[model samples]
Target: MSSFDETQDFVVVGSGGGSMCAALVMRSAGKSVLILEKTDLIGGTTARSGGVMWIPNNPFMKAAGVPDSLEQASTYLDHVVGDHNDTPGASRARRRAYLIQGPRMLDFLIGKGLKFSRIAQWPDYYDEAPGSSVPGRTVVADLFDVNRLGDAKSLLRPNFLNLPAPLEDVMKLPHVKKSWAAKKALARMGVRALVAKVTGKKYVTAGAALQGQMFLAARTAGVDLRVNSAVSQLIVEDDAVTGVVTEKDGKPWRIGARLGVLVNAGGFALNQQMRDQYIPGSSTKHTSVIESDTGEMILEMTRAGAALAQMDATIGSPLSLPPGGEEWPIKPGAQNVAAAPHAILVDQSGVRYLNEGGSYTEFCQRMVERDKEVPALPSYVVFDSDAMASTMIAGTLPGARKPDPWYEQGYLKKADTIDALAGLLAIDPAVLRKTVDRFNGFVAANKDDDFKRGARAYDRWLGDPFHKPSETLGTIGKAPFYAIPVIPGDVGTMGGVVTDEQARVLREDGSPIARLYATGVSTASVMGRTSPGSGVNIGPSFVWGFVAANHALTVAG
Candidate 1:
């Protein structure tokens, strides 16, 4: 606070989902809050993401009569994300804090007039785990009209879904050809689109909607938010973070924080150098994060004495790179479709390794781990011609015309026989035939003994719901086999500077760095390496951010 050009009670670096949450907290406490975003866009990856917050025992679940309790959620987490010495960020105390405070965080935000509702049917990724919520605890913001932001809408980050659809309808529409309910859902979406067109109101959904509401709420609360303001360094004094050095008029601008400086920047997913250094075999081109997510604050935190952890882990999203796919920031993830009926992933040697229908996070993790044993970096997703009649492939739905180049350039490898298809991928024809035949056997038995593909509700939920007998159990036969090469991509890197229950960054010796805090992907995740549900990353980021701001207020008091 001393000898600074400008100051605020709280200075948050990075305008991710957690940044606004913390700002609202400080403003609620009648303290001056400043949010500095490094990119021109106001929201970070959170705005472009699905924006679902997996907060168990939330009021949304209660309203829908979906039975869930803190104790049950805790048991589920304990089973899926067991306490590990390596993942210090997910310590027992931290896990308990998230469970006890997440519901409270939702209530607090609701009290401030930021609306939210849960996806009544989004199951936990590990649905078979003890105490898991079959009716998921996924909270999402309502579709927001961007016009409400006024001129500030221009500064908001763009979402992938140009015309965003409701989560419920999105899940249903994928099965439109096969399910009567899906056809109805499609009709509903068309109506919603028509109404918005007539009303001249531009709406954004998913992460965009979530962040839009948060951004509007923050502005209304009188929190000072700035874009294109990058904090280049943490100005530490006596091992305590006192201020930050950003830029003004192309010169150094010193901004001090009285209560604390929170580092919520982002992860190192988009920085290829950092990715290679931390998580090898990762490609910046493949990460789904916004290009601005380059992990600048992570290095700054380390310079300020913050200890980093979980550097080798990532929320693995299996994606395929077509010819010219590098042009797109968010490539088409193959995880969901690859897990659908009639499709199964295989190694270069044409051997099936793990369950095709399960947690996308686990799916990608298996690919990464399996790579160490065999050459599976660009694994083949083999499916039959029957799948093409129904499956959605790389953003292309059934009967939709794909770019001719997709087939001409070998992106869509197809042949009349399994042997021919395997030959296209340089895989052994007999090995692939055996693998497919074995899979078909499981389909006949309605059982996947190798990986338990359709054994869980979550797995079935992600499959083609209209498939008879079992949604995920369908034969890969019927001639003209096809395959696409898939590799491991990531939504965000799993590791960063480690923080404690208060969301205060800790040192290697296990002590909190004074006045230094972090949340979001900037800190080591609360679920450690495992993404137990849809919004584990975003949810923990918000909870810890809220916790940090409250802790700051107490300290200031």
Candidate 2:
């Protein structure tokens, strides 16, 4: 429907953060670029995300005088991810390469006019996990002005779950302990700040901000952009990627890249078969809204001879299944509840699992493991009235402008006694009572013998600092107890077509698949097992896009 079409030098697929970064990078280099988005509107899952792009040892970190070093970062990664011994060489190699080049990529984008803000308070997910830092690792993009992109607005996706709100506001929310306090505080402070923010609105998050800023920079460099083109398949010549077969206005057209095909298309989170196969017992409850995110591109790459990396691995977190789906007992819309300060995660058998106060991925993985060992994945987060009081929770800051709808939805349940609530939840009464008694004892003693809930700095970051003997444990002795069901969820899947450290697609034999590249959720993550700090996905997306750009440029040269 737009002006540009058909003849173009480069065709990038999927408008997620990864694809946008690649498109923008190539565009800025004075290369003709066309983004072939499958969906009518572009912005992929990243648009609907928290929009924080984590880059460690970045210029922002240095400028802020926050202490960090590559040695420290690598050490921390090594500690959390463990040895790369039996991993794919490409995965290991890409991570090493990403770490080395991430700072440069971050600085390059900043230099190219992408504004970045330091998440100074956001600590590494595992600050106590081997080589972790207390802070100075996670960086977020400054709220970008969406109006600057002109016609690109139509192609952009709505900001995901947290919309019409900024990260500053989304961070503040209330749970049982601080629900009323947070409600009253937000009423007092959220309105003025929100009004000011919108009037001076700057959009940020996922690929939109990354791509928007990059797209603006690229346009300044005179890159040609064509939207509404869907890539049907790859054009291969003599065993190398030559271009793409795309449909414009419902007409087929062959476009020549003359350089490379960058597969920044997102992963297969929405692919039902893939989800069922890789992520067991999860297809029914996925949280990804990018319906166009099928594994077609990944399939295309595999057919083109690209080796897959860690295809079984995924980024997992707890998500509530919609009311109709059957998998496990869950309280739908629990995320709407203010994340609790004194909640303890319990398995279906009414037993505590891993430390509940951890990264979404870690928590989900623990739940998965627990379910695999037992029979169900649904877990309960239990808290008391005092815990539901005015304590500053991890994700919910008191002054958050945007209210989490989950809280307003009554995903949380309140009752006068533990046994009474257990009966409602179908939890075994005797087991539930004993678990609460033990957990309360741990709260009083400031120790969680069962799961070591708050024993580490990483766990403490998302926990209540003011809570008594145990910062992570809160006694549920107060009458009118509360419980919310949690399920395994995720930002997106992480397995995909294997690519070399240069961001070039590679074959099973490890030979580069010429003119083919991928990044973001399109490829397996560079970080293997453990998720480091925030923005881990976005930071590398920028870096690999830069890498892919240079590789494409080299081919063009």
Candidate 3:
């Protein structure tokens, strides 16, 4: 047993959005806070994410002239999430709490000097739903200069860091060919870039910017942030979580919490055992989350008598896995490469199983759903020369001079003809040929009969607007076809310790565990089984973290 060395007024596990927000809120309320991060770097998986937070009726949305209401949001959630008993995830009360508190949390962060802007072009994942908006309710942090963070920037988790421009600029590039407004947006971005360069500031965008602002706020508020400290166990007294035992420097160190302990240490995306047990049949090797999300906090919370919910859920997506067990890191928003024109995803039997232009989560769910009947563990993304030339195919750059090394390494198969490519992929040649022929007919007719591929607004968003009739439809008639294997990969696991509307960890019998709180992927997701929109994961996380902090402060007072 490790002996107690010190005590804090409040202790927060994990250094992601939830934990950082909680720590900052508590510190602002005149409470001493300590944030323990399991990995050497802070920020957790939130730093690697898209950084968009889906908050309905937020002030930013209102300021942008996008109308939204709690009633409409509830109706939308009812359609997407359905019944709680059937979904077995976030309760209605919890959903209501998130909708109500989300704006307040955003305002709180703004007051703390964090800069955020509404993403005016991004739409809800299920835009056809009753409460869905075309110009979404999502907001993202502005590009932040690393110089503002000073020495603490080195301790933050690194993001994929693909597009250095602001998200508004990045989003406009796809529509530049069709919209004059998009071209103007790009020109504005160019000016911003020149200004940043002249100012001698290195700006980071997306998830990195969001986490950077939170980290700076936490440091400025006097939160005791510790990295390379893994919380292994919780200290309980009278059935209440009073402290935590962490593995630091190859030795166990115990630290007590006088107010409460909050577990926001992320999910088990990197733990093979947990992946096999919870999200079986999904490829464990293709997850996009950081390697540090091993569910240690889930185990610690469970050991402390917390109940679990939605263990079978994940924030899943389709990912290209290279051969020889090598992993491909995809930046946030890059998964749309699969939805580009002329590409079609097919199962082992060479059958199209889903809308090719659907959300990544929906695409992965289709892969899993089809796996029950056929061998769909590794689906093939097939595209032709036109697709390779016209747009990026599965993260491959557009107009590449030659085949990538992925082809030489057997991760990608290429051939001069459709039948030949199917043979190389070990798929039925006849089925694949017929499937492509039918898909070509759909493109020519400007309508998809089977899965309605390019029918939705979200589908068209991923496609080339310059294309005729539909943006997502283009004939795969060009020769020299290519195929790459895609698997069921995830951003993170969606299940963990159960928490109520107040963010208090709950027991199996529906009783709240005293002095224990949870948020982020460390608790059951408030979005239920479906992703409502971009940043749904981080939005409720921030709100619940705020709720937990305020509740703990009230208890302490």
Candidate of highest lDDT = 1
Query: Pairing residues by index, what is the TM-score of model 3?
Result: 0.93
lDDT of 3 at 217: 87
lDDT of 2 by residue, 129-194 (tens): 766777747766665667677766666676643333345444544343445644654564456447
How does residue 365 of candidate 2 score in lDDT?
78
Task: Point out where model 3 deviates above 4 Å.
Answer: 1-4, 86-88, 172-194, 247-251, 323-325, 329-335, 400-404
Q: Of 2 and 3, which scores higher on lDDT?
A: 3
Superposed model 1: Cα runs more than 4 Å off: none
Ranking by TM-score: 1, 3, 2
TM-score of 2: 0.86
Give one digit per residue, the lDDT tens place, for model 1 in 99-205: 99999899999999888888878889899999899889899988899889999999889887776476666767767767888788888778888998899888898
Candidate 3 on 427-499: residue-level lDDT in tens?
A: 8899999999999898889899988877778888778767777778888878788877777777887888889
* lDDT measured at residue 65 in model 3 versus the true structure, 0 to 100: 86
